[model samples]
Target chain A: MYVAVKGGERAIDAAHAWLAEERRGDASVAELSVPQIREQLKLAVNRVMAEGSLYDPDLAALAIKQSRGDLIEAIFLIRAYRTTLPRFGGSVPIDTGAMTCDRRVSATFKDAPGGQMLGPTFDYTHRLLDFKLAAEGEVPAAAEVEAGTAQTPHIMSFLDREGLIQPETDSDTTPPDLTRTPLELPATRDLRLQALARGDEGFILGMAYSTQRGYARNHAFVAELRIGTVAVEMDIPELGFAIEIGEIDVTECETVNQFQGSKTQPPQFTRGYGLVFGMSERKAISMALVDRALRWKELGEDNLGAPAQDEEFVLYHADNIQATGFLEHIKLPHYVDFQSELELIRKLRREAEANNAAPSESAGASGGNLSGKMKEGAAE
Target chain B: MNEKTDPNAARKAWLSLLARCSAADLDALWTDAALDPDHTVLRTPEVGSVMVRGRAGAVGSAFNLGEMTVTRTSVRLASGEDGHGYVQGRDKVKATRAALIDALMQTAEADAIRAAVLTPLQAGMEQTRATRSAKATATKVDFFTMVRGED
Candidate 1:
């Protein structure tokens, strides 16, 4: 007996079960803990924090584990959870100048306020694969060093002192939160920066690369990039002074851009800024380039209509969670829409076939006007 | 997520109320409100109500009880403009308030109307919610009675 398929839900459950088994791998191997992932696979945790816009490394690690190391899926889980959270209120902006530097470098200068200290980087490491890592390797010895007494001040401040760059004014106006609200066109600078801070790393990198290769070319120099932990503090209304709530790792990048001043304005250097959760330098730098490109209108530069320059397009499509959710949702059942299209095509084909046959049959004895009715239907 | 505060959902509600109403009623409401004729163009849509059912939790799926208003409406102004508003609440005042803004958008002072009428109504709704919550908290009943037991 012919019948319509009714086991779609059942099949989905079975498939999910199979996926879970695949994620766990062999039964003989011990399942990894969230703490272990957070400590050992730290880069993944950083990416999750950067995109998810959540600074909690532990929750990000758990999400990574639950999503079978699919970083985008982890980000989606974090974002969905983040939306449900009630806002206690915003903390005062963290001062990165007071951050105890773990890694500080300036591409523009050899020695800045904080000397270049490349802490915990794979930059100098050999590219050879290590066979020892196949099995869990022993921990390395701790670095021999005195107490960390010095803190890193921002490199942009050096240029700021000389009046060589534009000063980012403190307006005390709160920025728009994209997470809480739907995005609208003509977003502000603060809103754009927020979007870039949580934007997809690879997408930002590609756009940055395109700019360097001469599409909507805005000359950019990596003025400074810093990675460190900063303290988050919230002020109690009754107490007046703010108290430290917690600490979070952040990577900040500033790019010096060449901007020719207008008749009303004097010649001055402009800047691009990038701030991301956790220690992600590549993401932070790339974010800066893309940020600068988006400021074409405010900068009084020509609108080349580049992908990076269009704030509406970039800000709208940045988050991997939103992009992946919308893209993957297309895979959901659309049989109803497909069926309607199928019926229309079939009806049109039948009419065309009948019209061709009618001319041959009615050519002998009647008014052969199949084309006339087809025209009438088309008109309607 | 609170659909009550969702602008799109609220707009839909306003539009649906407009559809269920007569043109005379809409005109009377606007006329009574003393809206400028040169600025307004009102167009209401055909809407049918439905019950939305679901589940809720702080960390799990939300349950939507099927008893909500679930009104959907569309509006267009003389400035070749269109708006879609949806609300799941049965507050007729809210529905008309949204329609009035949509109608007034045809005028040059559309933004002023949006700022004055719509923004305040939204703020008032939020204020009313806060006040209601405070009142409920003030009257919160706590039962405390002890039974003596021998071990």
Candidate 2:
């Protein structure tokens, strides 16, 4: 008996095996340990943590390693793993106001309430690459000191004190969780913030760039950018008090937006906010800009038909994993769609051929080109 | 523990009433509760109202598609507290217990129900898991058993 070809299973197995071999590379090369990735490849780990919405650098490192350095896949793994962990309770909101900030800077003010502390930043580093380190990685320790100088207060709070902006009240109301529920059209500030925090850093950056490039020009300034740890606590009924669960390092950015206030309300500086899981400065800034663009309506600014201004456009397309998955999955089999199009072409061609068999363009042809039937009918 | 009355127990009672009552009877209850506007469904509660879904499917066969009797009611206590209870299946007692849990939960008795009801339910679930694991262990079939007489 003859058997028909069924190569899919075998092909899949072979492909996976080949991929595994490639990931490991030559046997001579030392295999990359998770710790090595975590410590040395810390930036990649940070990106995964920021986008993944999971704070574990080790897990992100392992995911990155397993995914063969595909950052998006690493993020996808983190998100999937995050869903399995049950939430015992929620955290006490970290008062970013009371943040013992390591780094604080405001472009608008030369000297603000809290003194400026530029904590461990690569801002002033020359673009020149160090070739000496490439030979054998060893750098003479640069002088280091504790960034204990500035106690920066939220710039928005400073403006709020003068009654120059909408007062944002901190509350204990159950905030919207996007992971647990389907995203709705009319989202609250909480949901929007959640989306921005986990959104693709690059995508948010470009959208933000577009806004600045005359798209939805809302003059925004980096009012405050702070990076620090915040206490997480859970309410214990037995104890009748919230207990500290853990502390997580976060990067928060708040942008002061220039917008015309409504009729009742006076023109004041509105705000845009970004809060992410790690020390991700670029992501934080981009998120803040996009956040401001999305808040056109709530702040009483008119939508200027910008892509960044559209809430639906930005929120839906922000996540890299979702975007990449849908984009890449198109490489899968699409023979059925191709076949349908082919059949439609053949049918259209047959009709055209039949029409062309007999000359339709005769005398008294009006309006446009006509088939033979039209002219013959006119003669009859 | 309010020995006299449990809010969850009351919810259970209403749930059973819904499952047992006809469409007309449900409408009558709705009318009695003055819920036509709200569908003030003293509405014949339905089980399986909550949808369980995922990328793979229903958390790995933990459930199946089926109709469940559900009952729900909005109650007003003498002290003027309003609460809702929805319970699954036709068991009036369970419905009542769930309703009691809901009502008490809304009031200061939230911790009490978590202690009394949810904790126990979670314990029962854990026990079930243990049993399922133990049974699987007993009937353990090693699929990778080597062939003794091979060519």
lDDT of each: 0.62, 0.59
lDDT of 1 by residue, A209-302 (tens): 8888877788888777777755554443432433333455677788888966878777778888777778898898888888788888877899
Report the C-alpha displacement of residue B43, candidate 1, in angstroms: 51
The 10 consecutive residues of candidate 1 chain A with the worst lDDT sum are: A371-380
lDDT of 2 by residue, B6-120 (tens): 5444433333233322333333333453421111223233222221111001011111110112334444444444444443323344433334444455566556545544554
Candidate 1, superposed: residue stretches over 4 Å from native:
A1-7, A147-151, A351-380, B1-151
Candidate 2 has what TM-score? 0.64
Interface RMSD of each: 22.7, 21.5
lDDT of 2 by residue, A1-380 (tens): 12222437888999999999999999897899998999888778888877887666667889999899989999999777666544434444555565545466777765667555565567778968978867876666433333333455677667777987655654445666677787898776667777777789889999989988989988788877877644443343432443333334567777887856668877888776666666788888887788788878876677899999888899999988889888987766554454455457656866886788864445234322433333333311
In the order shown, the candidates' DockQ scores are 0.01, 0.01
Model 1 docking category:
incorrect
Clashes of 1: 15
Alpha-carbon DockQ of candidate 1: 0.01
What local lDDT does model 2 show for residue B14? 30
